[model samples]
Target: MGDTEPRLDRGEALAATGVGCFLWVPATGQLILDPVGRDALDLLPGEYRGLAEDLRPKILRDDWTLLSGLSAALRGGLKDAYSAYFRVALHDGRSRWTHVRGNVVRDGSDGVTRVVGVVRDATLDLSPSSLRPPADEDSDHLHTLGEAAIALARAMSVREVGAVLGDELCLRRLGVKAMSLAVLEQGRLRLVRSVLSLDDAEPPQKSRLADSWPLNDVVRSARPLFFTSVPDFLDRYPRLAPHQHGFHATAAAFLPLVEQGQPLGAMGMFYENTNSFSLADHTLMTAWSRAVARALHRVTMLDRSREIAAGLQNAMLPRRIPETPGGRITVRYRTARQGVRVGGDWYDAVTLPDGGVGVAIGDVQGHDTEAAALMGQLRVAMTAYAAEGHPCEWVLAKASAFLAELGADRFATCQYLRIALATGAVHAANAGHPLPLLRRTDGTVDRLELAGGPPLGLPADWDLTPYSPTSARLDPGETLLLYSDGLVERPGEDIDRGLARLSAAFSAGPADLEELADHLLDTLTPGPHAEDDAALLMLRRDAA
Candidate 1:
C-alpha cells in the first residue's frame, strides 16, 4: 500500500461524500482514527494512536460480531472491497450510524497486510430501529449518581467501606436480597468481605471462573446479565444448577466491573423473589458498581506499586562493592519483614574523580511502594549531588532542598559521609539519622555525635537541618559505622539502649570489615524482625 501510486479519483470521491479516511495496520495493531471521524464518534483527543481492540467498545456489540473478521475477509480469495454498517456507541453518550467501505491490501501471494477504509455518517438514512439516538437522559442520571457514589466511597476508609457496603444505608436503598463484590484475583473471582442479608451465606464456593461459565461470560463481555426466573437461568446452564443448590434466589443480576475497558471483576445482586429491576434500580447499581470498581482499582494499583518499587530499588542499588582508591567499603541491606513492607532500606556508594568516595544510607518513611518510590527519587538525587563533586554538607543541603521542592510529603533520615583518600579525613553530614560510631586502633569505640538538621522533605529552606560538616581523621585500623535506626532500635526499648547495643556489637566484632558488618547486627539482635528494615554500611580506613 505504501508503494502504491496516489489515487486522485479516490480522494476526490471521499471528499465529495464528506467522509473520513482510516487505515488499520495489523502489524502494529494500530487504527489511524482521523480527526473528522473522531468528532463524529465523540472520542477523546488523547485516544488517537495504537488503537486496535479499543475500537470494539465504540461499535455496538451486536454490530461488531456481524462484521467479517480481517482473516476471514482475506482467506485465499482476494476479497473485493465491502461495506459495513454499524452503530457507534460513543463514550460521551452519543451514537452514530456509520458506513465504512474497506479493502484488504494483500501481498503478491494474496496474504492480507493492511486495511484502508473510508467512513461516513449515515444517521439520516438509518431508521430508529437501525440507529438509536444519544442516551443523554440515562447517561446524565447515571453520571450524577456515579459522582455521588464515588464521593461517598472516597470519604470512607477501605475498612469503613467494607463494613458499610452491604448493611449500610446507602446500599440498602437498592433493597437487594444480597450483594457480593468479587474481584478477579489470580484469574478467579474471590468474594471480598462484606455484610450480606443471609447471616451465614457463603458466596459461590467456586473461586475460579472455570467453575461458573455464566459469571465468566459476564466478565468477558463486560456486560450485565440478569435472570428474572430460576427456570431461565437453570435452563441456560444445567451444569451450573447443582452448584447453586444452597442459594435461595429467585432473581439475580451480575454487573461486570471494568476499568479502562479491562475487566476487573463483577458485582452480583440477588433477590428473594422473581422480579424485574426497575430503571432506577439499574441506574443506582450502575453507580455503585462504578464506585466499587474505583476502590478496587486503587487497591490493585497499590499492590502493583509495591512490586514495582521493590524491583526499582533492587535495580538502582549498588550491585557490587565500588572500587575505591583507599578504604574498604562493605554494605549489608536487610528488608523489613513488616514495618516497611517490601520497600524501605537502601544503600549506595559512588566514587568521585578526585580519588575520594561518597557514601550514604537512608530510610524512607513507608511500608508500601509509595515509600520505596520516594526512596528512589531521593537516592538518585543524593547520587547525582554526590557525583557532582559537592562536599558533604553541600550535598546534604542540596539533596534536602531537592526533596522539599519535589513535594514529597514524607521525610527521610540520611547520613552522608565523604572520605578524602589523600588525607584519610572523613567529613560527615547528618539529617536526623543515627549518629555514626567511630573506633580507634586501641579498641576504643565512641559516637561521633553531630547535631544534624531536620530530615529531608521539610520546610528547612533556612538550613533548618543545617549540615555542619563534622571532621574526623580516619587513621589506619580505625572504623566508622553508619546504619539505619532499625539496626539498633526496638519497639519498647529506649534510643540510648539501641545505641549502646550497636556500640557493643561493633567493639566485640572482629577487625575484618565483612565479618564485623555481619557480626555487628548479629550481636545486637538475633535476626531481622518485622518492625523495620535495617541497613549497615561499614568502612575500615584499611591499614596504610
Candidate 2:
C-alpha cells in the first residue's frame, strides 16, 4: 500500500481478522487493504467477493444504509463505527460468527468522507458447561432478567406487563406448561392473567385459589419459593393435591409481587416436565414481579383519586331547594353512571332585590376539574346579577357576555327564571336548556314557553335577544317545578316519556312544598349514584 493511503498494521490486522471478517471501502468504490491481510481475502469465493465489492459504491453514496447493512450482517453483536462483522459459511459446510467494531473518518474541511473500522472473528459458544462453573451462567441469566425487568417497567399498564412477561419469559422459552398472575383481593387470590398450552387434550382449569396456597404463602412471606416436582410440592402442602392432576408435571415456582414492602400479588410458573427453578430465575422473577406490582399500585391509586374527587364535586351541589313564597319550587340532580365522570351541573335559588326569587340552572361542557371550577364561577356571577335585580333575560345576557370575554366559549348552557310573588307571574329566559314544566291545579300541564339563545362563552358580537318571559296565574293548589335534565332522562327512555312522568308525579298528589319536593325527587330520580347531577325545585301556592 502507498504511504498516502491508510492501512492496518500486523497486530491490527490480526485483531480485526480474529474478531470477524471485515471489508472497508472508500467513497470512490475502491477497496483499501493492509499488506498482512491480503492472503486471507483470497479465501472467499469470487461470487461472494464480487458481491462484497458491489457494496463499496452504494455504501459511499448512502452512509446510513451502509451502516444499517453492516449492523444487520453482524447480528447486532457489533457496536460503534470502525468495527463491523459478517457471518460466512465456508465451502466445507462450517459456519462462523464474526464481530466488527470501528469508527468513521471525516475530512475536517468537508465533514463528509468515508467510514474507517476493524473486523474480527468472534465465534465462541460459551455454554454453561464450556464456561466457568456457577458465576458465568448466573450472571447471564441475571442480565437477561434485568432486561426483562426494564421492559416491564416501561409498560403503561399492569395487564400489558403481565402479557409480556407471560409470553416472553415463562411460556415459550422456559418450557412451562402454564403461567398465571393472581392478585390478592381482600385476602383471597383472584386470577388475573393465564397462559395455557393449546396442545393439551384435557387441560384442567383452576378457579380462584384459596388464601392457603403456596403462592399466597410466598407472597405473605415476601420471598420466592421453588418446587422441583409436583409430587414434592403436593407432599409439602397437601392442599395442592386436588389440583395436581391438571398440571403436566408438578414443578412450580412462586414469586412475590411486592412494591415498597407491600405485597400486591403473586406470579406462578409451572412446568409439565419436572425441573428445578434456578436461583437466578427466582431472583429475576422476583424483580419482575416487583416492577409489575409498582405499576398496579399506580393504576389503583389513580382510580381511587378520581372517585374521591367526583364525590367532592357532587357534594358541592346544593342538597335542597330554597323556600320561596307564592309558588312552590322543587329540584333534582343526577350524575353520569359511568365511572368518574363528575362534572359541572349547578342550580341556584336567590332572593332578588325586588322580592322575586331568581332560579338558575346550568351545565358546563366537560366532566373534569376545569368544568367544575367554571361552574362555580358562573354560579357566583349569576347570584351577583340576581342580587342587582337584573331581569332574567338581562342576567343571562350579561353572564353570557362575561363568560365570552373571559374566554369560556363553548362551555355552558343555562336557564334563568324570575318569579314575582305578588303578581303570580313567572318570567323565564333559556340559553340552550330543556324547558321547565308547569303543572296546573287542574288536570292540565304545560311546557313554559321561552325564547332560546346561545349558550354562554360565545363571541360578544353574537346576538343577545331579550327573551319574552311567559306568565301564568298560579292556581291556589298548583305547583311550579324547575329541574335539571337528568331527572326524567335515562338511557333508553324517550324525552317525552320522561317529561310525562314528571307531569304525572306533580299532579298525582296535592302535596305541600316539602312533600312535593321530596316526592318529585324520590319518585323521578333517586339514588346516591345518579348518572348525572339533578336539581329539582318546586313552589306551591297555598289554598285559600
Candidate 3:
C-alpha cells in the first residue's frame, strides 16, 4: 500500500496500479484512461465507445480469452488488418479500430513475471491514404499490364496465354470477384478462360455481358468504362438489370482487350458490395487488357508457326508409290492428332544396284519435331545402306548402331525387307516390330514371324544378334503387308485381336492392293479419329 497509495479517482487509481495506460472498469464496464491524452481516446466514435463499455467486463474477467472470441467472430466477415491498422465492425452499430503494443513486466514481490500490454488510441490516422500520384496509379496499372503481356508472349499456345491472363486477374491480391477472357473466333466471341475470386474460394456466379452489358458496349466501341455503382449503371442500361443481381451488383469496370484497333476480347472486375471503382483501378485494368491483347496475338502467331512446321514435316514423307518391276509398293502415313503434330511413322523403298528392291518401315518413340527429324535421318540411312547391296540384317544392324550412336540410347521399331526379283525370294529383319502379313491368292493369310531383335538405338551390350534376317519365297499371287503398330492396335484391344481383325479385313476384301490398303486404313483405325500415327507399306507379287 505504500507504493503511491491507490488513488480514489478511477483514472488515477488505474495509473497507480501500473496496469498500463488503459484499464477496464468492471463496475461501469468502461475503459478508465491514465496519462495518455484525450485526443487519442477521442478517435473512437460514440458507438465504438459503447462497445468498449460492453466489452470491458468480459476483458477484465478473462483477459486474452476475449481477444480470441473477437477474432473468431471476424474470420471471413468484413474485417481488415492492414499494416498496423486493425478494424472490425460488430453486429451492433459499433466499429472498433485499435493500436496495440505489449511487453513483459515483473511483479516486484514474487520475482515472477507477466506480460503487460497497452491498448493506445491511435485511430485518428487509420483512414486509407491515396499513395498513388495523379497518374501514378495509371503507371502501376501499366506495369501490371506489361507483366501480363510478357507472360502471354512467353506462352507456347493460345490456351497457355489465356491461362496466364486468367491467373493474373483472378489470383492477384486485389480480391477480384470474377474474371474472363474471350477470343474472336469466326466473328463470334468465344470464352477461352474464366476465373472467379482472387482469394481461395468458390468462384462467384457470372453472366456474359457481351450481348447486353456495358462490356459489350466497351468492346464494340473499343473504349473502357468504369462504374462506381451498379444501381446507377443498371438504371442507364436496364436490360442488364437481371444479370446485375448477386455479387455483380457491386461496382465494376470493363476494359476491351484490343490491339491495333482489332478487338480480341474484354476483361472485367467485379466487387462483392456496393462501391465505386477508382480512376486508378480503371487505368490499371485498361493497360492490363491491352497487354492481354498483345499476348493473344503472339499466341496466335505461335499456333500458325506450329501448323506450318507440321505441314512441312508431313510433306517430308513419301507421297506416291515408287514403281518397281515385280510388283507394286504403296505407302500411307498419318500424323498424330494432338500435342506436337510431328509424325514419327515413316516408309521408304529404293531400287538396289543388284536388281533387288529395299523397303523400310519404322516408328520413332515420340510425337514431336525431334521425332520427325530422327525419322527422316533413319529413312535416308536405310535407303542408302540397302542401295549399297548390304543384306537386310546387315543394313538393320549397321543402321541400329548408327541410331544408337546418333540418338545416345533413344530407341525405335523398324522392319526392313529386301526382295530379289531374280530369285523370287524376300529377306526381312525385324527390330521389335509386329510380324508382317502374307495374303495368299486363295484367301489364306499367313503372318511372317521373324525372331525379335532389340529395338534400334539400344546399347551395343544388348543382344542385337537375336534379330537375324528371315527369308520366304515370294510366290505369285501373294501380298506382303508391313505396318506400324497403330494400324491394328487400339487402347483396351488385345494385340492378337487386332492382328485377327487385320487378317480378316484383308481376307474379306478385294485383291486390289490399293483397295486393301484403303480398307485397312479406314476400317482398322478405331473411331473416326486416329489417336496415333499409322503407317502402312504393301508389296504384292504378280500373278502367274
**Per-residue CA lDDT of candidate 1, range 1-544, in tens?**
4798766787667666668878875433468867666665556767555566567667765344224433334321346466666668877665667777788764423222467887778766553232221223665455555544653444222322343344322332344555666667778766654223223343453476765555566776788898988899888777655555355777788888888877887777776644676676676668777777777676566556545545666765667768876678898866553322655567888898677888898887776677777777888889998998888888888887887887867788898988886678888888888888888887779888765677877776454636787887788778878888878766654577557656655775677888888766544444213356678887777677
The prediction achieving the highest TM-score against the true structure is 3
Off-target runs (Cα >4 Å) in candidate 2 are 1-303, 311-330, 442-444, 491-494, 505-531
What TM-score does candidate 3 reach? 0.46
Candidate 1 ranges beyond 4 A from true positions: 1-312, 460-465
Alpha carbon lDDT of each predicted model:
0.67, 0.59, 0.62
TM-score of 1: 0.43
For residues 202-291, write the lDDT of model 3, one tens digit per residue.
Answer: 222233444654555676778777777766777877755544323343666677877777777676665444375566766566656666
Off by over 4 Å in 3: 1-306, 319-321, 526-528
Better of 1 and 3 by TM-score: 3
Q: Which has the better lDDT: candidate 2, or candidate 3?
A: 3
Candidate 2: what lDDT?
0.59
